[model samples]
Target: MVDEVKETTVHELIASPFVGAYLVLRPGSPRGLKIPRDKYLQLGRKAADDVCPAWLVEATRRCWNLDISGRGVNDAVVVRTESPYGYGRASYGLNLGCNYDREHCYSTSA
Candidate 1:
């Protein structure tokens, strides 16, 4: 049987509350990112303290390279999980700081 795939944006992917790490499928590569939360943040910003994995280097292209060549890196993202299944494990909530503007810092389900 064929595996079910769902379409979602990278922003949504990072925000997904997956219970355990899930596989990320992309052209030319398919890997899972299961680093610690701190290291995951570093990977998000492309800042690695030590040598970065050769596959990890493509995180940027895979996340935001939404070029219109019908081949944008992000255009190919797909996950098997149709719904978030964890207790907000991947949730990155707003800063909700008093100093930050409330309007900009607040998150909406929209």
Candidate 2:
């Protein structure tokens, strides 16, 4: 059950920001994930604060570098937005970063 939960969470995480954007922007895109430039940095900083597991945060940074580095944007971070089916067209740019110190990273009401 724990493995199942982890798998689900990882899937959601990938689908929420990483691979989700890639699929929308570049269908049949090559393997790997594409996180927004700002998100990439935000996750790195958040990881320093111990917001999430260091491995997860580092993976995002590495993937962002590997995916975005060769795209003519030297030290540039790519930004793309799209609305997936059935989900509200929300902007991830608004998400500052995860605050593990808080109840949740996305609880705006708090």
- Give TM per candidate: 0.23, 0.20
Clashing pairs in 1: none
Q: What range of 10 consecutive residues in model 1 has the weakest lDDT sum?
A: 66-75
Worst 10 residues of 2 by lDDT: 69-78
Point to the candidate with the largest lDDT: 1
RMSD of each: 15.7, 15.5
> What's the lDDT for candidate 2?
0.36
Highest TM-score: give the candidate number: 1
How much RMSD separates candidate 2 from the native structure?
15.5
Global lDDT scores for all candidate models:
0.37, 0.36
Candidate 1 stretches greater than 4 Å from native: 1-17, 23-48, 66-86, 90-110
lDDT of 1: 0.37
Error of 2 at 65 (Å): 8.1
Q: Per-residue lDDT tens digits of candidate 1, residues 21-101?
A: 433323333333453444444434442234443444455346545222323223233223225335432222322225443
Backbone N/Cα/C clashes per model: 0, 0
